[model samples]
Target: MRNPETILEVDDLRVYYATPQGDVKACDGVSFDLRSGEILGLVGESGSGKSTATGGVLRTIGSPGRIVSGTVTLDGEDILKYDDEKMRQTRWQKLSLIPQGAMNSLNPTMTISDQIADVIETHEGRQPADALRERIMTLFRRVGLPERIYSMYPHELSGGMKQRACIAMSIALDPLVIVADEATSALDVVVQRVVAQTMLKIKRELNVSFIMIGHDMGLMAQVVDRLAVMYSGQLLEIAAVRDMFARPAHPYSEILIESVPTLTERKPMKINEGITHDPRNPPSGCIFRLRCPHAMPVCSESRPDMVEVHPEQLVACHLWKKDENGSYVRQSV
Candidate 1:
């Protein structure tokens, strides 16, 4: 468990799209907290608002994208009101993001060293030209990349190496919390492991937290301390990694964990049916009710409230109630 001194807190975080038809709720009433040296995994199928929720914290959502309602608090401070100047100053220096498809995030035209130097030069003020090369070299070695790769362009290095270079750039200022939006989603299995390992190294060295976003349950299990499961823009569950894998309270979380591929698992993988509804116009009630096998009448009548079931374990499902005899019975997922 992370120390109670929280570094980030997101309460009822919502990001929406102002479409011609109506406002699309990309992230709806999302809330979570993070502490130093902790990794919180945000897992959901595509368009489930995994990235949108976190992206709102970075204020990276572009035009047509708007945070409809929510509060993003960093170190007990609400950042939603930050002006452009404040955002520019706080970004990368206090908080940084290694966005999804980070391979393309780097400027292909610029040298690897130049890219890292750019962030340092922009935020850290001017320095002698001679010092810039040395700083880049120090960061490269910190991320376990060869110092010789500094002069090379992004095309020269392999995917894993490029990821490491990006990591070096991400931690150049040792930001409090790093948002990694599917940081390893684009790589092969071997490279994914490599990238995850390199990320661990960087995390330990910097003692920073990570908001890792991905749908791969197994991959997230390996790195994340706590898991936040999302379904159709709403966070359905958050629990310790072991509890979430062993006894997932939410039906959505159980499906995700059971879907993880295993060596001894010769049976066909469990696949969740039904597709995510378009954000422009969503379902009438619980977003997952259409696909949720255990859903009941109440699920379709109204959305469930996120209630605390245990320490650090919150589930947004009606299943956590009792039946006639007072025995806890899960709802018809």
Candidate 2:
């Protein structure tokens, strides 16, 4: 059984990619706490390294990927040192993954029933198909898909149905923590809403914590309790969802929230240019200083430490500092 108190905690996570050119620091010093029933949002641009950090949690980091340093504690126990024997047991049972691009993960040739059956079979401890089939049917119902989908092949399912099936597969084990890594990105708005609804339903019904990794702030705000902002390979801000959207502390987060298209104008907010593409070579001092609207000489010359703004908010910016007279000071660029 999983602990109801702390579901997952990532401390000082560092994931690097050893490439021919140089070591690319995809995730450096990433840390966060995931409580039971809490949804944590990982928001950032395309190459912000959010995916790599979560991927490392489940030991799913692809070739040349390295976890270099950090401790991933699931239910107060370190999971980084888990043996393959233990990892095989913990992967789906304790923590599950609903990967991005569901279309690519499903095998077109196999029927949905067989595909799901294969996962249960590979995991061990799960019962035979006869006993599991009924559960599979119920999973389909939970995800709002018809039970008849069990017999259909991957090629027979629509995009949304396939996505739902992937979710069903991930949740079959009833993991304590579910990492939905951009699970809704490929769908249309209607389907995205449906998926989000299903996710909420799953969370409520299963009492599982979530680490929702995606770039959609509005969508994330609707699902997660807190949002963690990442830039290059660093976490710039961590705050309550409402606080993040209402008043972001980090310049990078502010820029990201601003980029979200306001319904009034319908055009997305434009952020100032410049993001280092090559992860191996992030800029000196503050990684976001080059694009930060509030960048100061101090910001470009030294890295700002993570400063606690409130009981529940943490930010990495020199601007949140106060003057000796106890007045808040907003530094100039």
lDDT for every model? Answer: 0.84, 0.84
Candidate 1's error at 35, in angstroms? 1.4
Candidate 1 C-alpha lDDT tens digits along 2-89 = 3477899898888988888998888999988887888999999888888889889998899899887788888767888899888887
Clashing pairs for model 2 are none
Question: TM-score of the candidate numbered 1?
Answer: 0.94
Clashes found in each candidate (C-alpha, N, C closer than 3 A): 5, 0
Clashes of 1: 5
Please provide, for model 2 over 1-333, each residue's C-alpha lDDT reduced to its tens digit, 9 standing for 90 to 100.
123576788888999999898999989888888889988899888888889989888878877988899999997789999998998889878898888999888888889888777777777665866788887888888889997787899888888889999889888877899899998999998999999899999888988888999999879878888899988888999998999888887878877888777667766458566474456777778888777767778877888888767657888888888779765455654
TM-score of each: 0.94, 0.93
**Candidate 1: worst-modelled 10 consecutive residues by lDDT:** 324-333
